[model samples]
Target: MTSGGRRAVTVLSGFLGSGKTTLLRRYLAGHGAGVAVIINEFGAIGVDHHLVRMVEEQSVLLQGGCVCCTRREDLVRTLRDLLDQENSGKLPPISQVVIETSGIADPVPVLFTLGTDPVLQHQFAPAAVVVTLDALNAAAQIERQPEVRKQIIAADWVVVTKTDLAPFEAVSRCRMRVRQLNPTARITVSRLGDGSDALAPTRGAVRGLPPEAPAAPHSEVQSTALGFNAPLDWPAFGVWLGMLLQARGPDVLRIKGLLDIGDAGPVVMNVAQHVVHPPEHLAAWPADADGSYLVFITRGIDPARIADSLETFQRAGGRADLSVRELA
Candidate 1:
């Protein structure tokens, strides 16, 4: 959020019921700097954004799945607006941008955006994706959800939360599981510790900072485009998607992908718990590709495990087959 200099975008993502909102509220209040937040919620209702008790006009609320593939344009637009405000002296000198992606969000694409988008690249820097892992339910969720895997794969920092609710042994196990999925991310364990605990009060003027790295090509990061590849059968995909949902919705961080509704092209994949949205055929595949594919960003979940469960999805369909993977 360094004015004039490029900025940084930090993402906070985790599984459902992991107490992410509570931690985020604490961070915002105690951060003591000009920070804007981007909230990505699962439902059209937009409950999470309202739940965050902050008063910032520049904040953007995106009601959908992971912001990476689902509403990337929204991110680009929001950054531009924030930059404009900062330039005009209408807003405080900003320091950082933190995003609270949907519980099922895979932070990769959103993080990838900083390195990819042309305009955004000039004005912003890519901070590490900070993820929270629920100590209580992480094990089961990892076993069942592909979204969980994506969350972990994309994380540069993994925070283990809700240790107070878990037994001592449970906390230890949670840490072990987090390591299996991400060997490189820096991990911070917080049971009752919230954002307020992390940030100390500060009184000072913030200076603008330039981006850490040069903007790379956007296509290199966003090569994985699923739903645009081919037409997907609504009923068939539904059945397969449902089975995965039933087996792992609790583990789901946030589900966003492309689907084939019918003759209409953009049968979208927008998921939030038990309620999965039917396909809303858009004009065409977002970038005009003919084959439709599915990609997932998960935490503590394995792509192979997810694929094996949803295999009942081929058109000929003796027994369907499907798989979910984490994008680098």
Candidate 2:
């Protein structure tokens, strides 16, 4: 379950031939009991939805246009229909909802729909955006299609597919690019469709990295992780973060991390677009964890600018000793 009692929705996205269907089939075979699947395709007919329907009956198809683009309203209507079915006892109770976007789609619009639609927002919560990356072709794919960057930036987890087929150097390059593109996204590799567990929903996920000046924003978006060693003054840091998000929320795709606020337990922060989920405070830090870490996935913004602004605001607010570094 997510923050509230609402059912969670997971967005499955990837480039063409990135193994989204393989992972989805496996996920359904293992854990289809209370899940509703929606497959959107940009083809004339719904081949994948048909394939998925063979394994799971609780499935729907949105075809002919990209769900993240022209067919978004269809997505909204379909989601409402699913809820109506469950309400009328036409379908089993839905514990979760998963939407698989067309390989060419940009996930940001769908995320905006989820965060903005009042009816959907109340009934369904954002679980995670899980993206499949083809290790063999990821480096070239990123170079060829700019949309691929947005998919990675919006992802909460990236599953590197076809690692066995990819040479060690190819896989290595893919991993490096994934990290450089989305420093906070949890990445895992899989062969033969196993590792679907990484696609599952997580609660209050957080990660951070040491600071470094990134080259100019790669593509239209870029990501980096920022870490600070000292306990930050809550008000000072909060104000700085709030101002940044307020000013650039649209370009700031996602931000999440754990903060060390001295007296309090580690605090978990999450922000997507303009929406800031209530912060979660854990009882204690994990034994190996230390300091505060934040990951930022952004567009049209430089990591150095963000880091500089953060330090400036923090100092202006009188928290001078807070050390800030960007993850390499």
Least accurate 10 contiguous residues by lDDT in model 2: 50-59
lDDT of 1 by residue, 1-328 (tens): 4324656566778888776666776676566367777776643333233223222222233455433333356577777777788789977776677777777765555644455567887777554467778888988887788787667655556778888888999888777666555433456678575633322212110101111111231111111222222344566666777777667654554344545544645554434333343334555555533444455434455555655444436444442223333323
Off by over 4 Å in 1: 1-4, 42-71, 195-328
Q: Provide the TM-score for each candidate, comma-separated.
A: 0.52, 0.78
Once model 1 is optimally superposed onto the true structure by TM-score, how far is the C-alpha of residue 278 displaced, in angstroms?
A: 38
Screening candidate 2 with a backbone cut-off below 3 angstroms (N, C-alpha, C), the clashing residue pairs are 210-326, 210-327, 211-325, 211-326, 212-326
TM-score of 2: 0.78
- Give the Cα lDDT of each candidate: 0.55, 0.73
Model 2 lDDT per residue over 1-328, tens place: 5656777788889998898878887787777777787877533333333223212112122354233322256567777888898899988787777788888777656665666577887888777788999998898898888778778867778899998899999887887787777766778888888888765666514543323434444566677777775777789888988888767766887787888888657887777555565576777775556567787878889888888888777778777876677865
RMSD for each of the candidates? 15.1, 5.7
